[model samples]
Target: MRNRLKSNEGQNRRKKRTSDVEPVFGHIKSNRNFKRFTHKGIKKAELEFGLHALAHNLRKKVS
Candidate 1:
């Protein structure tokens, strides 16, 4: 048996990502560009979500 955060386990988890999200909410509120989705339907929303995630990743890579 093993404990959590032991032997660098927790450190590994901390090294992983998070936060392709926090700024989006702020952007939506502060910038009208992201506020309100004119797009409709679950399928369309899902596609947009995927695209946003992909774009976020690409941006992170470039930066």
Candidate 2:
């Protein structure tokens, strides 16, 4: 929808990868804001991703 990210092309053309990132992303989607992070910048994006990863790892270890 946004001009910055092409929808049909991005969703279909991007190469899918197997990694822990997918499961972590699934858990993070419990929050609506996370479904589409509005931040603008590599540092901010990295921080948000790192926080999600940290939460996921902690939950996995405790459970």
Candidate 3:
């Protein structure tokens, strides 16, 4: 892991990856109260998650 972090390509990838995802998760956990999914199966779960994300974005837009 240390060696991987040392390379230029790896460093850039790491920076890009870290910037990409953390905030959405933090908001979902803290603001949305999204702890677990209620639906079962792939389609239902995907729909539920999409709705949650849409709600989160709408809240962001409104506030």
Candidate 4:
């Protein structure tokens, strides 16, 4: 694991992956105040996350 992280290709991939998704989650957690879900069941939790993801996508469209 340490050697892979130290490799040039691995470092590039890691930077690209984190840059792509980190901001979206940071925005969701900070701006949307989505620290935790209120729903209990698996189905409800899925629905809740789906809604939140949809909202995030819609915001992207508007901006």
Best by lDDT: 4
Model 4, CA-based lDDT? 0.91
Residues 1-63, candidate 2: write the lDDT tens digits: 464246765644443432435655666787434676567899998888788778767887999
TM-score, structure 4 vs. true: 0.71
Return the lDDT, model 4, position 19: 91
Candidate 3 vs 4: which has more lDDT: 4
Clashing pairs in 3: none
Task: Evaluate residue 32 in candidate 3 and report its C-alpha lDDT on the 0 to 100 scale.
Answer: 76
Name the regions of candidate 1 deviating beyond 4 angstroms. 1-32
Give the lDDT of residue 42 in candidate 4.
92
* Model 4 spans with C-alpha error above 4 angstroms: 40-47
Taking the tens digit of each residue's C-alpha lDDT, what string does model 4 give over 1-63? 989988998899899989998888788889999998898999998899889889999999999
Estimate the lDDT of model 1.
Answer: 0.62
Better of 1 and 4 by lDDT: 4
- Candidate 1 residues 1-63, lDDT tens each? 256655586656645523545676565446535555557998887787667667666766999
Task: List TM-score per model, in order.
Answer: 0.46, 0.50, 0.69, 0.71
Task: Give the range where candidate 1 is weakest over 10 consecutive residues by summed lDDT.
Answer: 13-22
Mark the regions of model 2 whose C-alpha exceeds 4 Å error after superposition: 1-21, 30-33
Candidate order (TM-score): 4, 3, 2, 1
Best first by lDDT, ranked: 4, 3, 2, 1
